[model samples]
Every structure is written in structure tokens, then in C-alpha cells.
Target chain A: MKLTFPHLGNAYIAVKALLDELGVDYIIPPFNNKKALEIGIKNSPEFACLPLKINIGNIIQAYREGADTVLITGGCGPCRFGYYCEMEREILQDAGYDIGFITIDAPRGISLKEYFSQLLKITNGINIYKIAKAVKNTTEIAILVDQLEKLTFKMRSIEACRGDTDSVYRDFQQEIRLINGAQSIKKYISQTSQKLTNIRCNTGIKPLKVGIVGEIYTTIDSYTSFNLDARLGNMGVEVDRSVTVSNWVVEHMLKKVFHLPRDLKYAEAAKPYLGAMIGGHAQETIGNSIMYSQKGYDGIVQIYPLTCMPEIVAQSILPAVENDYGIPVLTLIIDEMTGEAGYLTRLEAFVDLLNKRREMAASDR
Target chain B: MRTGGQPIEALRKGMEYLAGQLGNIEIRGAGTTGSGRQLASVIIGADIVKNEITAHAVAAQNLVPEVKTILEIGGQDSKIIILKNGVVYDFAMNTVCAAGTGSFLDRQASRLNIPIEEFGSYALRSDSPVRIAGRCAVFAESDMIHKQQMGHRVDDIVRGLCQALVRNYLNNLAKGKLIAEPILFQGGVAANVGITAAFEEALGKKVIIPEYYDVMGAYGAALIAKRKMEKSIDTNFKGFDACLRDYSARSRECSGCSNVCEVIELFSNDELLASWGDRCGKWSSRLEGRPLVAR
Candidate 1:
């Protein structure tokens, strides 16, 4: 059976490695584009969030490429994401595509028998030993890709020549499309990171540090966030993203299964503001905001789709965080209707504000 | 100075008028702000191009050094900027909606066959104002019509419209922020006394309108230009004579990729000055040698 999955930042790279190792046939849909967004808006419910709409577009795009079954992740939360896979299956079925769905939630969320059955469907008669090896390789690939991206983020801020870091990163993305297995992908990532490290940087310059914290889907997916991390990095601001695909996999998916140690620092930071996990990274948003402020970030940017309940809650509470920490926080609510001009204006204005604040403080000193 | 359906023509006339008013003046530096800043900078050779939020905040700070909040409503956009210690602490702009701005007010005034300038006086004449929906422009228009049909007084309807716009602006842009005083209201819409009164009534505080409210963005651009000129070796100002030159803008969809970015090209006389709006810099970067507009 041919399989297809929605894009989630660099998670696709790991998924590709896993499916390849499993010896399963799969198709990666075109990168998030205007057509995907258009199809998503046309097919999705009027009130649904942007990520779900985009996922619809991705699945439909893949269906056109001869994929009959769709692969997606599931969750149990107050956020609407927990219902996405079920809703999408019905939506697509009503639209008359007759697409099959394979949802992979946390094993704890589903019965062991059901989880293994879903896994076997994708594994295609692979032995348990092979499956375990594939999972290990896939996890390593995810971590390596995220590490490479973090290096790119840092290099972009300090590179002596503008676009130097971007050029290398872009070339790596283009080259990765042809490489197949996890080992090759891991090797390519190391080479790219080395190139990023070799780039000449003006180390003396203390760039303004900005932390990006928000909904997991929007924050991780560059398309949804309008390439926010890259945009800030290009503007010479040091960017620290609160979430990454690998981080999510480790913290949410693997930590419980493997009984790994949890990093409660962000949670402890968030305790004063949000004690409980309401759903969909709301606690993480507050926790990361407080963490960034304590780390002396110049500013924090919160990005989320319009009508996202969890982020809406987080947005309201951010002002309190800003006041107590004396750090400026910019909340950008985006959707299909978000204008590029207005978004750019807000980002530029935020940067200018941070610069002026720094200058004033320096003068006062 | 309004674009009035023809930005190039309006810019030409505006610059020529300014030149006539200040004849024989040597321009040391120049900058452009507002939505059409890129186009304006290309036409007049601006040394710096800034966004409206920064422009508005700077101008407000220049006028009232202790100002804490700035309420700006231009033709198609509105913004709320909160300042602390002479620095922009926070700000929000109207997102994907233009429900309550000067253009909407202008359209409503014309629909009522009232002079736009006199629309506010009618608001002041009414004591009992009707409530109108202000969530969306279309809804507000239909609601206004329903009020008019119900025999509401024109003065009261006008006052209701002002209050509706103010409510929409506050609900949309000023959410969860402390709008501390002294608040400065500046923009084309600040000329509307009705909006000013509504703002005061809603916030329970007096709103101060700057003397040059209509041109505050330009004023801030000038202030920025002055500061830039102090440290710069030379100015990019092409002088008032550049305003006399023919300028035109054209847009074409690039089919190089699936993105289909609509690249805009600005021209001076018949020469291709610069092109932008491409997601991939292939089209815009072609004119890298020229003084490209930096948004």
C-alpha cells in the first residue's frame, strides 16, 4: 500500500528515513504552497484552524500522486488536533476520494494490539529486529536534522556575508531530496553543519536575542509561521525556537515510552503562570516565554493560527509575563488571510523597538 | 494627500505642492513611510524607508515626549502603539481586516451624501446615539442602513457610526494592553472630531490630536531623515526635480515556479528602476545595483 503523510517541519526527513528502512512505498507531497493552501481552504470547515486546512491540502495533493492511504499522528488533548485525523478521513471520504488512514498516536493512548496492527501495516512483514533498528536510525536522523537547523540559525545571525548561511542551507535541502537512507541523511547533515561552522562570523557583535514560542504545529512548520525563524535570522537577530520536531518526538512521544528523564526546567519556569497543561502547548508557550526572559532574551515572539484556543489562552497571559519580566513580547496571529506586508511591518517594528530599548538602556548605564 | 485611485499622480501633485510651499529650500535628507513607502522611496529617492508603526510612534514621541499611547487610523489601516520610557513597548495593527478606518468612514459619509469633513459635526449634535455592529465593515454598513430605515436621526446615526468604528478599533487592536495616557491620536482619521469624542467616551480619557495629525507619518519620516543625515556622508534625496519626472508601477506574475509571486516593477520615465514582490529574489535581485526599496 502506498502511504502519504503531512509535512511537519523537518519531521518529514525522519519519516522518509523510517519508511525507506521499512521498505514501504511512500510519496512525499509537494512542499506547502499556494495551491495546497487553496485546496485546504476549499475543502476544510470554515472554522477549522490553518494547520488542519493545510493538512487536508497535503493529503489531497498526495492522493493525486497515486497514494491511496494517508499516514498521520494522533493525540489526546483539549486542542482540536486530537480530532483532526478522524475529521479529515470523513471530510475526504465525503469528497469521494475513498482514502484510507493510518493514525499513529502514543502507544499509551491506544491498545497495544491496535498499535502493533497499525505499525505492521506500514512495516510490511519486516521483523521486529529490523523495525527496532529502523526506529533507532529514524530518531537519530531527526535529532541530526534539528541539530543542523540550530547551527544554521546561529550561523545566519553572525555570518559576515549576508545569505551565506542560507545558501548552504538551501543547497543542503536540495541535495537531501535525492538521498534515501538515514545514514546518508545523517552524514549530509554533519557535512552541512561543518560548513555552517566554517562560515566567517563577526563574533564581537552581540546580536539581539529573540525567542520564538507558540503552538507546536505553527512554530515548527516554517510555512505556517511564514518562515519566521529564517526571517529574524536574516535580520541578524539571534533566534531560539522553543520547539523542534526532534524535541517534540523526544519530549512528548518517546519520553513516556522509553521512561526517559524529563526536562522540567521550562515547566518549573511556567509554574507561576500556568500550572497545568491546558492542551496544545499552551503551558509550553508560557514556560518557554519565562525561560527565554530569564535567559535575557531581548524579546519574545508568539505565533499561532487564528482561532487556536490554546494559543489564545497563552496570548492573554503573555502580557503578565512581559510586565513581570520587563521584556517585550510580540504576538502575531496568522491565517490564510494574513497579509505579507502587514506581517513584515510588525516584525520590522518589533526589531526597531528592541533596538531602541537596548540603546536607551546602554545610554542610561 | 490621498492616492485617490492614482498613486503616481497623487505623489507627483503632493511633492510639487510641497516644493511650491517651500521654494529654494535645499533638502539635506529624505525618507518615506506608510504602505506605499517602497513606491514613494523609488519616486523621490528616499534615503530611508520605514514602516508606519515606527513612523507614527516616532512622530508621537517627538510631539509629546511623555506620550504613552498612540492611536493611528489611516485610510485603510489602523494601529495602537503603547510606549514606555520613550520607546515602543508594544504595538498591534489591524489584521486581515479594515473594518474601521478612514476609508470606511469616507465611504459611509459619501453613501449618506454628507461631506466627509462635516460628518463629525453631525455626531456632536446628537445626544442619543444608536448602537451599530462594528465587527465587520459589511455588517456595519447593513446595520447602519437598518438604523436609517428605523427612523433614526441622521445626527445620531453619524454618532453611532463613529462609536462603532472606535469600538471595533479598540476591540481588535487594543486587546489586553494597557493604553496609558497621555495618549496621542494622529492620522488622517484623527481629523474626525466624532471619532475623537467617541475615543474619549469609550476610554474615559481625553485624546490629544497633534497639530499636524494628517501628515504625522511624513513628519516622522522627516525626523528620521534628519537623524540619519547627521551621521551619513551623503543624502539620497534626488531633490524636488525628481518629483517632476514621470513615474509608473507595473506588476506581472512570475511563472518560474509554483509560487507564482507577483513581482512589481517601478519605472522612472521609461527606465526600469527596480522590481520587487518576488518570494525568491530572482526578479528583485536582478536590479541589485540600483537603490532597491528595502521593506
Candidate 2:
């Protein structure tokens, strides 16, 4: 049976590993792109969020490819996310796509007995212990792969700033993939670390640094943001990011749900700045921006999808934060047709200005 | 629940402290994703922009070696993803109604003079669920009132509301797809016990709620960033302190065409950085860094 879950931060990695272990046949839709958006927009309600449309588009593509079952996540919250499964089912039915629809509602504080029983229904009595082992292996692999990839990318910028980044990255990806096959997380980490240390690059005189902020999806997904990270790196500048899937799940999902102290104090500290909960992660985004600015970053960039409500609220209030902190903040609104050249030019200019400012500061010092 | 002057300032200070700890990790390049990516890219001077699907999928693949299904629910929407091996195969989303969402419950709670915090606990105590139309928020409300008038207990009514929402959700979003076990339920809504119970009852299955439900989107984005960051030789990050500058936007009606598009111009300390909104690039072309102007 093909099982699937809606796309989220790091869910694909976790689920993919488990499925592989279970030996279940499944298919993942292509990354969100114009085609996904096109199908989604054509099928979805006009006022739906971009993510929803993309997801619908993904299902359409999957069904067209002969996939039968669609797996869904279950939720209950003040946000509109909890009800997506029902709506999507209707849309697909109306569209005449016949397929199996299942939803796995994660238990909040309930016992695992019920959940395990449910699993048996789908797994047909597959070894739970085997499943557990697969999950463990997948998690370890995922973390290791993620960390290595991040380090390699970081090293690329550092190398590229001084030149020869293209060659370095080419070799790095190959080496890291080999290391990813390691049997343990420690082995993977050490192998990857050794690989990174061997790479050499000329470090440029300190370049200006910038912090990125905004809605979670928009800030981190390159397809949505038009590969802005690569563009920035190509411009010979350094960047710092504060969001991650593991941290979000571990800190917010686990901690907030369980009512535990958050590892990142800023989340707790920024709670009050957000005032009434506007829903989504707008509060955290704004809080991070404020935090980044105060810490003396060169600049900050805020990105959001067109017409996102919470982000609009954050945008409306960011001026006050910017003024209070005295940092340059640039906000970008993206849609399907957002031009690449236009985006790049603006970034190039921003970096130039920042670079000049840094030089002036150095001279003054 | 903190509010007003002191809280905001205190939060800012706390953020600063965190920023200080992050140190000077020069960003080579940055990318933006999710619903609000546009504004995020512009604000952070992103060199690349991507959609949440690609970003999330990439992140998930990086995190999990082999995956099967992904369940994602967030503040404004919900979705189901099916993955076979390592590729995304199928997915669905719900965006129109708020009937099964947390905000709907919150609204219902205030309307019924019940504290939202106690909603789930109350639902658990329900002996028999009252029938409430969960097809739409307005219908559910009227139906709930009618049920109350008919002498239905509050707990039963609440439980019924939860079930109705679950039915509506399944009927609408997951209509024609096959679902499998080992499902990961994520996003902010996963926190609700009543809804969780309702889903379990509907599916007759157990769902795994990931450790980070509320901030999964951000975390996913961050994970992607981490990958991108690691591969790069330099970073485009402008440093933490750079965020504390005056950024402003102003909109004006473009009279160049019948569209009369409201052109928005972004500024940082009196300098125009970017402009958008004109359909034909009328206003956008005139902006300082825009290529149309340079051409």
C-alpha cells in the first residue's frame, strides 16, 4: 500500500526512512513548482493558501501517475490546518479520483496501545520491532545527512567568497553521499567532519552578515523564494539562519504541547512582544528579527507569500522594531511570476551597500 | 499573555541575547519558503526563493532516509502527503473552511462562555455526543444552540462538535486517497486532544504526533537552510544586528493603466529598495535597484 503524508518541515525525511524500512511502496510528488501550483490553483478554491494549492496539485499528479492511497496527518488547533484532510477528500472526490484515503491522528497524551493497534491494521502484523529499528536508523541517517549537507553548503559560501566554490561543492556532495552510508550517526558525523576539514578555501576579509526572517515556509524553502540563498552566497556574502525543522518540533511541538521550558529562551522571551496570538509563526519570526538586529547583524531580510495575513500583521509592526533596533530590514513578497533578474539585482545592491558600510566601519575602527 | 510596553521591550532584549549567542556565521546565500516567502526573501535579501513543498520535501528527505506518509496541519491549512521510497507521490490540502480548526473551537468557546483552555478536558468527559452539523461553522453554531436547547449536556455537545469536524475534514480533504499506518501528525492543531480523539475514532487508527508540531514549518525551513548553509562557501546573512533598521513601505495608485494597481515601494532609511504591484512593471521598473530601470 502506498502511504503518504502532507509536506511539512522535516516530515518527508522521517516518513521516507520508515516506509523504506517497512518495505511499503509509495510515491512522493515532485517539489513544489509552477506545475504543482498550476494544478493546485486549477483544482483548489481560489482563496486557498499557496501551500494548500500546491499540495492538491501534488495529489493530482500522484493520482495521474497511478497511485491509489493517500495518507494524511490529523490535527486539532486554532489554525485551519486541522480540517484539511476532509476538504481535500471532498475536492478529490468531486474531481472523480477514486483512491483510498486514510488519516493518522497523532495522539496528544493518550496511550500508545490504541495507536499500535491501528498500526497493526495497516501493517498486517509486520514486526513492530523491525519498524522501530527502521525508524531509529532513518532518524539517525536523516540527522547526519542533514548536518553534513548544511556544513558542505556553509563551506561552499566560505570557499566561494574567495573563489573555487563550484569545484569544491561538486566534490563535497559526492564525498558526503558516501559518508551518509555509514552505519552509525557517530561514524557519519566523523566522516563528514573529516571531509569538510580537508577542503580548503581562501576566506575573504570579513563580509557583512545578514539575518533572514519571515514565515517559516517562505523563509527556508528555496523553490518558493526563488533560490535566494544561492543568489546571496554567489554575491560573496555570509548569511545566518535561525529556523530548523528539528528544533521547531523539539522545542515548540514537544515543549509547548508538554508545557516544558523551551531550549531557546528567545521564544519564551518574545512571547509577550507578539501580544495576542495572531496564529502561525509570525510572532516567532518577528521576535527572531528583533533578536537578530539587537545582536548587531549587518541587515535582515523578511520574506512572505503574497497576502499571508499573519505576515501582514508582522510587516505592519516591523517598522517600529526596525526603528527601535536601528537595523536595515528588507521585505520581499513572492508569487509565481516573481522575476529572477529583478530579485538578484536588488540583492546585489543590498550586499554592495552592506559591504561598503562594513569597509567604512573598519576604516573608522 | 504579557502585553504592552515592557513586554515587547523585554522580548526584544531576550532576542538580542539569543542572537549574541549565535555568533558571526557569515551567510553565503539564503533561500525563502512557505506562504509568506516573498516578504521574507525581500526582508532578508534572499538570493533564492522556493516553495514550501520542495523545501519541506527536501528537508524531510534529509531527515528521514526512507519515508512513506507525511501528515501536516498548520494554523491556516491542513495537508496529507504520501511518499514512496524517497519521492513525494501524493498530497491533499484544506484551506476553505475553519470548521475543524482550532480557531473554530476558540470562537465557539467564547460564544458559549467557555474557556478555550478547558475545551479538550471537557470533551473527554462527554458520555454521549450530541449531533451538531459540522459541515460549516455557522451551521454548527446554530445546531449546537438547538442541541443545547433540546437539553443536551455540554460535554456531549462538545464531543459531537469534535466528531462533526472530524467527519467534515475526512470527507473533504482525504476523499479519494489510500492512507497507510505510521502516519506523522504535525502542525499546531495536533495539540488538541478532542480533535485527536475524534480523528482516532474516525480512522480507527493511531497517529504519531511528531515532537515539534507547532513550529514544524519553521523547523523544516531551518533544516533546509542548514543544508544550504553547509554546502555553501559563503553566506548571504547580513548578521543579527542588521535587522534593527527602519524599513518602510508606501503604496500609491498607478494611473498608467485601467488596472490602477496599488504599487508598493519598499524603503530602508529613505532609500527605495524595491517596488512591486504594477502589472506591466510600470512602478516596479522605476525602483532604484530594479533591472527594468537600469535597462
Q: What is the C-alpha lDDT of each candidate?
A: 0.87, 0.62
lDDT of 2 by residue, A123-210 (tens): 6579879755754665565555456545644665565223234334334333432232224434645565666756666655454668
- Winning candidate number (lDDT): 1
lDDT of 1 by residue, B1-295 (tens): 6688887788888888989999898888999998888888878888889988999888989989999999999998999999988899999999856888999999999989999999999999999999999899999999999999999999999999999999999999998889899999998999999999999999999899999999999999889989989996588788887878877889998775445678999887789988878754555655445222222
Mark the regions of model 1 whose C-alpha exceeds 4 Å error after superposition: A106-108, A111-116, B243-247, B253-260, B268-271, B280-295
Give the DockQ of candidate 1.
0.50
| Stretch of 10 with least lDDT, candidate 2 chain B | B1-10
- How high is the lDDT of residue B146 in model 2? 94
Give the C-alpha miss distance for residue B201 in model 2, angstroms.
Answer: 65
